[model samples]
Target: MTEMTYRQALHDTLREELLRDENVMLIGEEIGIFDGSYKITAGLLKEFGARRVRDAPISEEGFTGAAMLGLRPVVEIMTINFSLLALDQIVNHAAKIHGMFGGQLGVPMVIRTPGGGGQQLGASHSQNIELYYAFVPGMKVVAPSTPADAKALLMASIRDDDPVLFLENLALYNTKGDVPDHVEPAEIGKAKVTRTGKDLTLIGYSRMALVAQQVADRLAESEGLDIEVVDLRSLRPLDRDTVIESVKKTNAAVVLEDDWLTYGIGAEVAASISDGAFDYLDAPVRRVAMAEVPLPYAKPLETAALPSIDDVVNAVHETLDAVGRRR
Candidate 1:
């Protein structure tokens, strides 16, 4: 095992995939020359040349539409917000091609973009709009919270025969974790059990998954609460069974999400728990989500708008209280 930051893991995995498959190519603005906005594709241009690490104009729709046609293209939109420009191509053409054509053709492409607030990029740039792509039927969405899963999931996304929306959290770029020296591609639709506890189930994905673990550990130390954490690795083909099973065991749940509460991923999760494990639930599922307004540019306001560890902790406490479990 090798400990590395999430950025390094993603870079290494992209490099490894490029070497392993000749068909795998990266296409995006500034990816080749400027080395990407977050530097995830740094130095790849010199290593692979212009043909493989191709750079396009700053046009999301044009590049996205072009990249989807052929090759196993990893199209990196500057941010998830910019992805909106290519929504028509992504939702109408890329996503529906396989199903619309009777499975004769498939878009083996990957749209990799970073989202979420932290650097004060303001409301327009720092939005966590993953729910948009994950809502589409033909798109496969994967968000990895740890460096290890980042590598594994990226490898899997690159190799898959479907169009994948690879969600990266800006806050997690520097986070460090152990990654296997020899890793296998993670099963795309699976959820991971990061921690086990009997008191309540804490579920999240992407950045919030890391937050869930933090809350679990903090509560374990302070309140002696056994909190089980379920990380939803894939959002579209959400592993509802894993979530339901965890909630069934714990009999209570608190969902943490970086997106807004209205029709957010957490809402889907809470509904899943209600549908699958209604009889097992000891209390109504609680959801902790970002403030409904657009994320603020000011650091303090942005911090206040986004969901924090305190929000999750408080939700857990309230859920436990409702269940008659005083922690």
Candidate 2:
């Protein structure tokens, strides 16, 4: 295994895929000359040349549409905030083409973008709006919290026949972890249990998944509570079974998200637990999420609006206490 940053893992996956498949190409604004907004495509243009590393105008809709028809194009939307510009194409065409046209053709494309607050990019540029795509039916959504998962999931997404929205977290770019020399593609709709505990289950995806791990560690040290963490790697084909099984074992749950609370991904998880494990639940499912407002531009406000380790820890305590399960 080799240790690398989250950004490096993604860059390596793209380079490997491009070399492995003749049809695999990359498209997006400034991806060629500029490398990329976050440098995930750095040095790729020189190796692949202009034909495969073509740059598009500042038209998300136009380029995204072109990618849909192209041969296994991996398009970068710069950031999730900018993906709004291509929502019409993403929701209308790329997602619905296969089902709409009676399976004659499929949009085998990968849209890579980063989201989450903390860089002070302001309300417009910093937001965890992946729920928009996750809510849609046709597209598949996957968010990787670690370098290893990022590499594996990217490989899987590129090879899949359906369109995939690869969600990256801005805060995770510099984070480093050990990744295998040779990795297999991760199954898209599965959730991973990062820790084992019996007190309560802490469930999250993307950045929150990492945060859940941190919370679990702290609870283990401070409160002597065993906290289990489940990482929902794929959001669209959410592994409801994994989540339900974990909650059943723990008898309590706390859902964490980087997005706002209302109608957020946590809501779906909470409902699933209620439907599948209602009788076994010892307490109502709890959720910790970003404040329901445009993420602020100021550092203090942005931090305040986003969910933190403290928020998650507190939620776990409250959930446990609600059912007198706290020791």
What TM-score fits each model? Answer: 0.98, 0.98
Clash pairs of candidate 1? none
- Clashing residue pairs for model 2: none
Q: Which regions of candidate 2 fall more than 4 Å away from where they truly are?
A: 68-70
Tens-place lDDT digits, model 1, residues 1-327: 999999999999999999999989999989998998889999999999998999999789898875445589999998999999999989999999999999988999999999999888989998989999989999999999999999999999999999999999999999999998999999999999999999999999999999999999999999899999999999988999999999989999999899999999999998999999999998999999999998899999999999999999889888888868965
* Per-model lDDT: 0.93, 0.93
lDDT of residue 97 for candidate 2:
92
**Which ten-residue region of model 2 has the weakest summed lDDT?**
61-70
Q: What is candidate 2's CA lDDT for residue 149?
A: 99
